[model samples]
Target: MRFYIQQFIRTIMMAVFAVFFLRLHVTGELARYVNPKYDGMSQLAAVIFVFLTFIQFSRIWKSKKDNQAHCSKECSHHHGDDHSFLKKVISYVILIFPLLTGFSLPPQTLNSSLAENKGTLLSEGQSLDIVQESDDHQYFPAVENTDKNHNEKPLPNNNYLQEEAYQKKMKTLEDVHSIDMNEDIFSSYYEVIRASPRDFVGKNITLQGFIYREEGLHSNQLVISRFLITHCIADASVIGLLTEFEQASSYEKDTWMEIEGTLDVTTHNGAELPIIKAKRGRVIKEPSNPYIYPVLRKMTD
Candidate 1:
């Protein structure tokens, strides 16, 4: 029974170490080992770690025989202080090396191999980029309402707001527009979280950000984007909300619009989807400096 309990404890510890190592590998925390830019010494450390994990597991099967050979019976030396201390030192070195290398990562220092697959980080200096890209981007172009009569006009609705868990702070049209027109969203590390089913699933939420169009979808449908900044603008990502108005056909792509709506769940192609059917939506003149939101892949990553 005592032997079984000891084996169980050892197995648990090994599992913990394995899980920790695997997570660091999967979430890209282990990029330094695979990076060509790392110095030779860094690469050597990685190879040593891989070798150590294998050797430690190898010792388990021969533990009794090894102990007997290393400690003579007449000497009565069990695997005593010196051996125990060495084991501890080896464990510490093995565990600490991987994490230490991970901590040395610089801002956006990830490999270029994965960079194209990742989202672009934006800053306040790139506000013009938002204007140009968003204005030029076409999600559903043919349906864009170019008719002067159909252009969006602002509607005042003091009672239109439906309370939510996450609320968008009411900023005056002037206050929102005046947020440093010269600065870009990337420089500000600004992010917009929306109250749409796509993000929060079923939760009611409010959103504040500039509108962007998706080409394959209906022409009037727009995606409201907000930057999700992690450490800096260079690492920013964009999050989106899908908005559809009953009179959606009346609006153009890239129109600056404010919308208050309920969360709606729907599907697109084969996957689940979210739709915000506006309770009230009105267009405002494109703000002098618009807030561009970043895209974060997963919240905890």
Candidate 2:
């Protein structure tokens, strides 16, 4: 009973923090402390937590003399009251394991886990490197070279030349916009980018919009977003393309740019790939909202 009371107090405190953590103004660090990812999985966890906490509270209440006295008349069994604390601990740990894992792992790490394999885990060290099937992003392990290595003679002073080239590349990219969206690339909403995942599975596509970051995903990829609303931007969820440009290094997240590229299909873990493709285009900064379209849950063309 005492253990249950202590658990109740801790759960209450966590619930309070979760409310504030999900608030719009909360910083990422604070939010992670309370709700971690705050994505669908985290939201589901909060719901389950609330449900289980109530069940525990009910059990704790039933342990009291007044509750037992009143409920005994209506019920025949209070078997859970006699359950050992070790059994309770084991049961709670099994039930709450998912929530603990969800809140503890970083969001991007979660993405990799979803995309790759269940056996994958964050490295013991602090490095951002992840274990993936390929080196699609910088944080993950390098991909194996698919091209066969011929026994060609090595270039003289290869290391020095590579260093010099890298330095020059860095100098060129110092002022480039991290994200670029160009409005002219796509004439109308439907005319350029196709919304159907079926039709565009293996084709090239382009999109332009303001940039935003997502948890459990790569940072450099542009989330070409458009606000869909039944009422307003508050309810305006984003539906757009997730792509890497052929010359994408110049653009920054949230910077506007018009992308011109081909469509490609990719599979992440078991989750459907979020319409990822390749493109070659110019990036240009502009106002956040360039097009005015009706906000619907799904885009139908």
**How does each model score on lDDT?**
0.42, 0.40
For residue 159, model 1's alpha carbon misses the true position, in angstroms, by 29
Give the number of colliding residue pairs in candidate 1.
21
CA error at residue 276 for candidate 1, angstroms: 0.5
| Deviation (Å) of 41 in candidate 2 | 40
Please write out the lDDT profile of model 1 over residues 146-213, one tens digit for every residue: 44533444231112223331132323211242222111222222232222234433333345455655
**TM-score of decoy 2:** 0.32
Q: Over the full model, what C-alpha lDDT does candidate 1 score relative to the true structure?
A: 0.42
lDDT of 2 by residue, 120-236 (tens): 221122223212322342232222222232123212211112444444433432333232222322223332233333444444445555554344445444455543332332333
List the candidate 2 regions with Cα displacement exceeding 4 Å: 1-198, 246-250, 287-291, 295-301
List TM-scores for all candidates, in order.
0.31, 0.32
